[model samples]
Target: DDILPDGFTKVKPRKTRRNKTDTTGFPPLPPPKSQSETSHSTASDSNKQPVPNLSVTSTPSTSQVPEDTTAQPPRKVRVTPIVLRDASRWRGVNHKFISLGIKFERAVAVDAGIRIIPKSEDDYRRIIRLFREEEVPHHTFPLPSERNIHAVIRGVHATLSEIEIKEELQQRGYSPLHIIRLKRGGGVPMPLVVVILPKVEKSQQLFNEHELLGLAIRVEVQKNSRLIGQCHRCQKYGHAQSYCTAPPKCLKCASDHMIHLCPQTEQEERKCANCGGGHPANSRTCRFAPKKNLEVIAQRRNVSYADAARDATRAAPSVGSSANTQNVDLATALRSLQQIIGPLISATQALQAIFPANG
Candidate 1:
């Protein structure tokens, strides 16, 4: 090394580089090929190593699956509320109120061929009272002249069946009822048989739309206990009271054929007054005895049976017609008549009330 110029430094001899093949030979021996390959190879070189052992298996390709156009998303299910029709058909019919123990109550009848019902017992009572008080004239306002279906839908509390509904209508003196089907909430149409009762406009007007629906619901839930036995004492249908055995005495006389059908018992039993004993003071036979028949001595006195009988009564000895005598006679007659036909009259009245001619 020697210092030459001010900017020059000491010079040293450079080292020579090695050749590429001598520095890093091939990646390592590839090893020999297979025996089968060796037989076909042109030459087997030791420098070249055999191929590494590795599994090479081909996987079958899969085609892309086409999207399913028919597969649909799950549909939303919705339950529609049921709307009832023919509810008003059972109006004016009689229904048994189990809670109240009333065998019969005026039911909401039909308007335009539909039955309607009240919501609560109060409403029912109010409606019934209105019908009774108003009668035919209850609704003074002119009705909607057009035929409109008066439907009452059963609500959540419905319990009545079609048969029971029909029976109730019949009991209230309605002939028959029809069950028709109506769709609820615009979904499916269902059978909705209508039980038509007496149509009273007055009563119908009292109910609002909701009340009418409720009433129909109530009717649907009503139950009917079938009529079976008969009351022997009353000689009527229904249940027979334990006391409904044979009469103790003859209803006509106090005889053992009722012990001659006792007058006091007959009166108590609401029997005909004329048949009982005519008078509490006299027996039935004596009270019904014909008046004294007086014969006319002269042929010229020929008279009709009515006139002759009248004449005989007039001629007969009588203390005088007094208020007390007349009262006694009338009382006796009434008691006798009551004993004979009282039950019949009662039955007739009941029939009339249940099925009024106009009703």
Candidate 2:
């Protein structure tokens, strides 16, 4: 090989290049279905249109709409963080933290720390200035505000379809949830529907039987588990972390390097991504995880998993269910399988969490 000119270096052409399409406009959309198809759809779904989902405002694709605040239920103003120096030796107090005519609902403790929930926006604003008091525990700012209510709907007949459920809810004149999913339990055709409600207030109404198209379905509303996300790699939420597309961050120190390759020698000095605390970010103990999870929730909602599993566009199972087998991607197939066994998997996970195997 001959010596190249100064600053010249050997170069190899990229073997793989993304195919670029030169076009001035987007491809044409599919033609609208005929009136017969529309009529048939209307008839099949009992003439009710899909209700407007409200929680989708967090998605990047969705623009926030101005709604009458007076019309809606009480909004979650913010989460105020508090830290107790002696978390283990702390005594439970019944009274609310009051200051300047402002009152916090209650102190929810985690470890030796607690987070205060102000009654409303007005209270939060009033207490904002005096929030960081010198006497009480350290009150932190900007906690995750979005709240979730998990409910398992029962008494839905095997024949009760997703479309019918949506139609029924819409007919009831309730603000529709962004996601109301039916997770199939085992080999059963009918599934247990897990609804993610936009408001915590919905939990009260759920205690009563919900009449969905003559089917008096009972909704058992419970607080969201707020379980740490299962990492795609490790399968446990608060364990080995995988950045996936990005470079892995150190689980201990939260540095630029991987956990194993972390150069910081002090193992005791752990820092979390969720909270600026001395612990791994993956730890379930991180009180800040819930707030961080709200962002994750918003990101996950981009895809309509329930509808994808339902595959309404595909021919009815009667015609030929296996017709699309050749065209299905790995993710789609996985999603379909997940839809079938999600309830079982969830229950199993819950059991596992409750009773971890002894090493």
Candidate 3:
């Protein structure tokens, strides 16, 4: 029994220590509060503002950032390699290329025709070699319109094999195929494939789609424009696939195997071996293709139809256009004639005044 002292009612005993094993069990769960208590807690939560759910993380505060006193070395820049895709349209264009949407990066190193802009402008430059698909005819001065056919190829199979697709087309009598292409990200095959046909008859002609491959594989003609003249076999620019002499290469990777034979998995990131880029080798985001298109467009805008017609009349006998040269020559001759006749006319008028004509 606990002791009792004066002025105290009673004394209680202190709690005894429990066995360690007693605590082995899980801690007691929170008790279920009374209805009033739960309602009050809910009310408190409702009264407070909800935190915003943002996808982007908040930036660290300035004080949270660590300051480094160590000196840092300069980082080496990796320059993008570039090539001219449409070399045929490069004719008659003089001095430096420019495009609004298209950007030209300075070259870091020169590989073949690809070059980095040197620090010194006065440095003696060797002739820059440009890559081309087919041999451009020297006589093609005005530059012929490109020839190409755009078609949408729908596949019966859920997954299409690019190499086998050709075999199916060959069976359907679509012979001598020039170019076949699908969009990027070939992880799961798409139902529709866009293709280019260089042998098409007309420009911007629409034709009905035809089924081939003994399957529901059908090709519908879209727009027929000038061929971009890219080589599917070599995965190179400037020549047609049919005329390609280089070894077989992948369009997606510029690899040794055919584009259909590439082993690129969906999990792996796409990369271009041609330009060393994140996109595929055949991507228009490539430096070459867009640059060529800009050059073609710029040349077209610079050379008017009337100028082209006049150019066709004269076989480029001089540096300047025939019409301009003729106008300059005529102006010079008129000035010379005026100068030669000025003294004679003045002398004749003076003699008439001296003689007092009809006195």
* Number of the predicted model whose lDDT against the real structure is largest: 2
Candidate 1: Cα lDDT at 93: 31
Better of 2 and 3 by TM-score: 2
> What's the TM-score of every candidate structure?
0.14, 0.28, 0.25
Which digits, one per residue and each the tens of the lDDT, describe model 2 over residues 56-159?
55454335555556876777545443333234323432222332456667657764244456666556645444433423333233334444556677777767
Model 1, span 81-103: residue lDDT tens: 11112344233332423433433
* lDDT of each residue in 1-359, candidate 3, tens digit only: 54557655565778997745546567656779999999999999998999888779879989998898798998854322233333333432113333212223353322223333322222112112212323322111111233355677776454556667667655545543443444433234456666555554532232444555566555577653443656666655655654333457665555787766877643345666467666666665566553554345446669754554445335321222345446767887899999999999999999998897794
Q: Give the TM-score of candidate 2.
A: 0.28
How many residue-pair clashes does candidate 1 contain? Answer: 72
Point out the worst 10-residue segment of candidate 1 by lDDT.
Answer: 136-145
lDDT agreement with native, every candidate:
0.40, 0.52, 0.51
Predicted structure 1, TM vs. truth:
0.14
Worst 10 residues of 2 by lDDT: 315-324
